[model samples]
Target: MSSLPDGVRSRTVSTDRLETHLLETGRADGDPVVFVHGNASSSRFYAELLADLPDRYRAIAPDLRGYGHSERRPIDATRGLRDFAEDIRALVAEIEIEQPALVGWSTGGGVVMRYAIEQPESVASLALLNPVSPHGYGGTRRDGTPCQPDYAGTGAGMANDDFIERLEAGDRRADSDASPRNVMRSFYLAPETELDPELEDAYVDALLNTETGDDYYPGDATASENWPGVAPGEGGTNNALSPKYLDLTGIVDIDPAVPILWIRGAEDRIISDTSFFDAGYLGKIGELPEWPGEDEYPPQPMVSQTRAVFEEYADAGGEYDELVVEGAGHSPHIEQHDEVLSALTAHLDDATTRIGNS
Candidate 1:
């Protein structure tokens, strides 16, 4: 809606000749702290987060290629995680920020981390907010469906396993048999994880009226295959789609010097292990045995989908910190802004103090 606060410049950066939406805030001379939004969300996702911070620090948020103002360089191909990383990299270079600190939410976590890996000299640090665990993200259904589509017929009919999987995997038509009432009712789950129903209703109401989400729900087949941000086929993940443009498979273990700050919502199903962000499924990643004597492999759960960031972070032995926010879900910036700010402020204070030291 409104531009990302004041003082921060708003602009577009061209990558591979394609333009992407970018919002810059804070004093022009301040150090750059770039923001990357999650899938199906734009830079606007960080509007509240931007407002939560102090003016002394400059904050930047960019819309990943397809979701927002950013143009899709290759629309027909897959928009993988690597491509998302490239977009951020190109944007940073375009803006002329020297190794800006990268901060992302959800899928943004992967992008910044990969960027840090590839351009270690260009990174100051990494901050993940309810980040997507390397293992994978949890969803509404037991099968990892984030939301239920309308084609399932009715109340109970829509929750069917086959139906939900097909929908998340992008195989079914979202609107074919969907009912508006059903779409809305299914938004909530047991114990009410969110603080505001109207907040969700507003989004649902907006989507119902939007061009893609509402009446038409034209449908995207690959929505379920792991968000547009991370490329599945990269490390032989075997995800249905590969990143359409950039190749980002070989950059994970970034410079040992870069510090990592990770925050997880205590009840965040999307990141922790709520029915939406299963911690059990995540823990299982460590259960798998690794190749004998492979130093390249960081540890078990090479790519944790949830709590494992702490695992990976601790193993790395940097100035690592993790926070467990009580009663929060996927979007900590929105759901628990005040608490998240305090945590972030504490980290930044120490980080800024140690600037250029690392």
Candidate 2:
């Protein structure tokens, strides 16, 4: 387990839905703020953020089922991210937290979006960091349209086998590109960011905590006649993120809008217009063979899709602010901590004020 900062405390909260581990700090009676982590990560990623939050705010980071010290519950991909969202609902309720400002990173962003959509009344505000598209991870066009009916070239099949092997073996060496440490350095943050050795080891430990199997991390996949030749299966994290089951655009229809803060690293490769993880992007870059022309299979315009949806969200009476941290990558909150924290705190304060006035 990674060492917790001085003010932060760790504990497990059991609810009917799932047993979740949480890292929490700040005053117990203060306004609540919850942090949701991305896939293959745990609450440990937010240890610093939780510790640094203003003393007037209660900051809590939960380990979603199957990640960190949380229970290894089977995810039902067919329900999209609802399982994860519901677990969060249970946790908040069990802890007596009401209408918290929800901060979600990557897949956790998708999960919270689903939660806000299902129960917008429960969310005071929403903060998304490098989130997956509202249309889900891949196999979708700019307008949230599926390129292939079967939604191929996504889900568990997209996960790297070598990386999975290394992760399963708990390989901590930064020797290979497939190693968790290397992946975090190469893809999780900007190339120029100098990572502290101890912090690197802590992050690697969090990465290795991911539960691996067909029912977990990458999930399962099946044959497809589409270009990439693989479609989403019925279980696991990746499949739940697949456009086949996840669509959060209904956020535009929430009657009473939840204020949203969208933050991302300007140099993010994982969730960008040309994401390194997307097969369509890879095919365009000539990394994958048998290039199907752009018209047939173009790279997903992920950032564009998000912008369009946010615009629609605005037009529908919701408000949002987008911040792009220059020298950061997927984890802007970590790469440029002070800057991101400044904006996040202001947002949370504003949201809390609005809640109080209402």
Candidate 3:
């Protein structure tokens, strides 16, 4: 494993739902800030961020179930990200973390949003970094409507088989388009952006730690009569992110509304309207055969959906800020470290002041 970032410590904590491994930094008495990593990643991704947080803030990043050093527990996709959210709840309780500021990246964004919804009083603030849509990842419209009744063309079936194979095999070499390293470089960051070699290796190492099977990474897929001939099955992480199961639009209605910071890379291909990872978008671009017309299967307007929902939240008396970082991709936190940190810390500070004043 790559060496941990300075001042970061790794430990495992037992929760009611699963055993969670986490990276932590800062003083025990400092204000709590929890960082949740995206899918196909682990807490290790946040080691440097945790190490660099302001001294007055205690930062914690946990490996969700089926990732990192955490227990390999089967995800219950039927509940969407609730299982993941509940795990965070359990961890917060176990660690006695008080009114934590929550930061979630990619799929982890869905996790924290769900957490805030289910446990509205728990979160002090939320930061979403290149997150999935408020409606879910794919198979949805700008108004949060499902394109197909069965939610076909979403979930584990959307995953590239070759990439899954390489991930399961732990192929760290960037020799193929499907290799985890190459995929990360291509889709996870700004095109041609080169990470520090050690951080690159550490990120890949975290990616490799993802548990793969019908019960994990790509999850399970069912045969479909729809364009993709596959639909989400009721198991695994990917399925949990499927719109058929996950609907985080209710976050707008959470009481004691938590302030939000939504950050996205301007060049992010994963969560954009024409997301490269979305099958519907692929069909529109003629990347998939037997193309379904745009009306029947349009590219999900993910960013628009998130914006619409946040607008509703704001109208309902909540507050949020959206940051679009240029020359970056899906993982802006890694690609534009200084800029992201500055925005994040300022947001946290504002939240801290709000809490103190209240």
What shift in Å separates residue 134 of candidate 3 from its native position after superposition?
A: 1.1
Per-residue accuracy of model 1 over 1-358 as CA lDDT, tens digit each = 3434454456777766458777766776777788886643567656666766777777788876555566644322233355667767877777778767778776677667667767787777778876654433321232222222311111111122443343335332335324332332332211344435444543333223222221111223222222111121212111201222223323335555566788766555434442321222322354323212222212222123334444454566655677767756566666677888888766766666677565
Write down the RMSD of candidate 2 (Cα, Å).
0.7
In candidate 2, stretches whose alpha carbon ends up further than 4 angstroms from where it belongs are none
Q: List CA RMSD, all candidates.
A: 9.9, 0.7, 0.8
Going through the candidates in the order shown, the clash numbers are: 25, 0, 0
State which candidate, 1 or 3, has the greater lDDT. Answer: 3
Ranking by lDDT: 2, 3, 1
Query: For model 3, what is the error of residue 115's alpha carbon versus the real structure, in angstroms, after optimal superposition?
Result: 0.7
| Most lDDT-accurate candidate | 2
Choose 2 or 3, whichever is better by lDDT: 2
Instruction: State the lDDT of candidate 3 residue by residue for 1-358, as single tens digits.
Output: 5799779998899987888899899999999999999999998878877778898998999999999999999998999988888898899999999889999999999999998998889789999998889898888877878888899999999898999999888899989998999999999998968998888998998999999989898899999998878899998999999999999999999999999999999999888998998888899888888868888888999999999999999999999999999989998888888899999999999999999999
List the candidates' TM-scores in order: 0.64, 0.99, 0.99
Off by over 4 Å in 3: none
Q: How accurate is candidate 2 locally (lDDT)?
A: 0.92
